[model samples]
Target: MAPSSPPLPQFEEAKSTTSTVLWQLYHHRPRSPRAIALSVLTFFVLLYMLNTSSSQSEPNFWTKFPSQHPFPERPEDAQVALPQRNDITINDTLPHDLEKPNPQLHILLPAQRSSRGSCRTITSAMILGYPPPTLIGYGHEAHGTTDFEQMVGRMKRTLAYLEHSRTVKDRDIVLLVDSEDVFFQLPPQVLVTRFQNILRKNNKDLLRKYGVTTVNRPGPKTAPAVVQKYTQRVLFGASKKCHGAHATDPGCVSIPESSLPPDVYGWKTDIHPDGFLNRPRWLNPGTVIGQAADLRLIFKEALRIIEQRQKKNGDEEAFTQIYGRQEVVRELERRRTVSLFKEWGYKLLGISDATNISTINIRLETEHRYEYGIGVDFESELFFNQLLSADDVEWLKYSNVTKTSALQGSMGVPREHRLLLPTDVAALPNPFNYSLLALNQTTLPLWNKTLDKLPNPEDHTWNDIPLMTNAHSASVPVLAHVNGNTKLRNTWWEKMWFFPWARALLRRYVRASQGFDAAQSSLLGGADWWDMRGGRGGVWTDHESWVRFADVCQGQERDLFDDDLGPWGKENGDPDEPVYNEWGNLVYGKEPPQLPQPPQLNDINDHW
Candidate 1:
């Protein structure tokens, strides 16, 4: 048959093709089992490497895990009305049915007598329409011989006021500052809004850092997983230098890094001979803000540390130690919940450990004891601690949309300093304005024609500029703590926007009844913090007694008042006098005038 096919060309070609196929099949024996397995393993290894590298680059990846703890609740949310943008207008006369707002703001300035600087703090707060501060340790001289002793006295008195006072509720906001150093820059509205906003932002970061999130539960419900909850409720001013501790102590070395950019201080960052280039990571007791309840806890813990140590240590040391320990505990909890493989991944990625906190030893009680929700204003969003950071700030006006960019650039302001758009800045309403015509819809002017045109020629328009801003952090700090170069206090105080018309502004603030902006209050989760009674200038003492604002500020007129702007009282009033009331009453008698009791809330909407 082959010989017959050879005679046919088609048959011979088919035979040749079959032979070639058989030869290829024989030579190409199934790849060796070992080689195939090795190849597959290499492919998987490459894929995993790629996946891990990608995740490492993403900041949030491997940082999120479901939290096991419950979300904290605010009781004020139920009592305060949700703010609407147009719910209320700035009015000269408050409604008769107005009631005390929920979670009222309480300022605490502890001092023996109001100094020029302390008086400036009081005057600024008043001008900005803040509630009368409760003066802790006022009229008490000779606190202690040492600086530590003085700090302890202040903390003790502050804690006592928060713990025993009836007027200050647990939820009420309390701002405590160094009586002679700190000064308010922004209004209470901005302070409250920024505070809540900062807390929210910080808490979000804390949650991520702790690798905690919320996830779905068994059914339609959702719940936090087996993880710890980390949040920041109490914020303290941040400083570049650590006080009351040695360079290598946990207080100095164990604090978390500041959230500010690495180059916030330019080329000298962390390398300056004076330590001015370092980040603001240390806790500053000079200025702090928190709820009354949280404040009480932190103060109590600090005082306990001071008493237990029996050393010359102060509240600053105690606070620093506390913060260090809190971070350590948080890191321990974070690692405990995270997977071992993730830990290895983190090590490979060069992410530094939380802190060299193992050197710090403290009794780890319930999480609540260590976790006072203590956090620092690293960005100076709420408070600026001017220690080594004196040169980081400048005064620039953003209300002028056309000039803002040029001003920032010419002034050497960092790009981060212009975070707020010119339109946003220009559109900001003057919180101090309290007329029917002063609706929230009306934006502040770049020049303030009425104030700028005053007969007395001064370079500043109080309505035009905000106070000292930290260009490094892009923060318009609510208050400034002049902790460094004591002489700067006077110079910086003069730079304040309200320094020229403080007396007049203070009167305007007190004369208008305290009310809440629905939109702003809503930002604080419906907590009305502006609950001041109209027409008053009295400060509640740590002993629960009252003192006249005029009495405290009598000798401080030179620093707080602009005589050329006229007196704080009615037209043609004495320019040098301190007027405390609309009735022309110079001072009240032994018993202080009683604030009107809030109208009974027959219905929830009655006050509204």
Candidate 2:
């Protein structure tokens, strides 16, 4: 009651007096310009320190951002979505030419000599309905002293050729393989379909593991995180060992573990002396498949690294470093992003511990260049590296259920075969499981009925032509790299299903009509075996004109065909000639043309 009586004097006056006293205290004396400036400077310094502390680097003067900046400072700005399979619209970006149907496949084989191995490679590809290969470095002499140096030289020349080719486009899928050791077992259609499918599935898994996230852009409001994901755009054949780098190097130790099942190789996984049971986690440059642009970028960077380091064994090492650096930078970015979001109280986000630490010390200026979209074929689906895996594959007729059944409970069969047959061991009409491929499904239930429906269907049924299947992973690889043992090259080449009827197969492949059966095309996702170089399959030589298949492969009859095996139509009383085109023209009609003389070399060192 007493306080109320006093307040009646002036409630409003008391409030005004209190406000005036506070204002006077705040501005008892005029603030100096230096004091105001100092206060502002302190606030900004604290903000800069906060940002720089995350990257452990000084802010760049020009950009005012940390060197090797993993991601944008604002978490909201990191949202990135994976590109859809159908979203790739290369046709629109290419130079319009109605005359040319966009070629989807390009094969790159680098060989200095047309040896038995090289001839067999060319012959096998032709037999399997592949377009003519661009024989890179064919006319060049061996450059370096060591095998490694020669390998690097071949890589350099191949890079040069791809860069110069007008026919090759950014979107085209390119297959690069070791000329002498690699063999094409499947048709172009199977290779392309499997490639696209592998990439699709691998990318989908990656997106689920790394691409999804939520972040606050401006404030409390959240948005889907668009983090730049690591995709397996360019896939190289995987190896049991990281060939070129040291054991402790990031290339050898820091790569994401192989995606194969943990028990893929059983108890002897990494301990096997033969390395047959080891997981294929390392990169093998012998066989690579990727988009033209992606391959070009990787090779370009590899060449740069070679020149900078003057490395003799740089081919695989350079590639391994590139991949390792990519993983390292990606890991840094991932760690930075996680730390930033965690600071903002984000929890429950999944982070992978696949790679714990990286020994790679990537240069700050070149951090952006490490992203070459590199990956390895861990399952040996598209490319099989035979470095330490000589006994892993078998030539069995997948369509013949009896072949697998015969070995099921037999003691004479290898232990691996007796354990479990590969997933692709059985007949598979729908190999890819793609619904679109079922458009023109046929009555025959065998996989790749296209091969079965050849000229003499009975003479060369699906049972006759076997395919190479990887026993451990149950994969029918597109191609095989016979790298470890040179002695096995001829034996394995003979084991190929088409080897027995190479002449007949090559004839059938070359003379195939403009369009494949609609059913076959549907199975191949509209891909053709020979659509490159205007459908006249041949080798792109150093000469002005492209060399036809007959020119490069005519003389190597022994390498290309098995005389003892005879022809496919032998039961019908063999045709007049061993090889004849669909129009009854002799497959090897003319004398093989002389190869173009190699350009004069100033010196061995100068050529590379």
Model-by-model lDDT, in order? 0.65, 0.63
Q: What count of clashes does model 2 give?
A: 5
- Estimate candidate 2's alpha-carbon lDDT, on a 0 to 1 scale: 0.63
**Superposition error at 558 for model 1 (Å):** 1.8
Q: Name the lDDT value of residue 507 in candidate 1.
A: 50
Per-residue alpha-carbon lDDT of candidate 1 for residues 130-162, written as tens digits (9 for 90 to 100): 767777888886733777677677778778888
Worst 10 residues of 2 by lDDT: 74-83
lDDT of 2 by residue, 30-97 (tens): 78999999999999886655444254442322122122223233111111111122422424332232
Name the best candidate (by lDDT).
1
Error of 2 at 434 (Å): 27
> What are the root-mean-square deviations of the candidates from the true structure over C-alphas?
14.7, 18.3
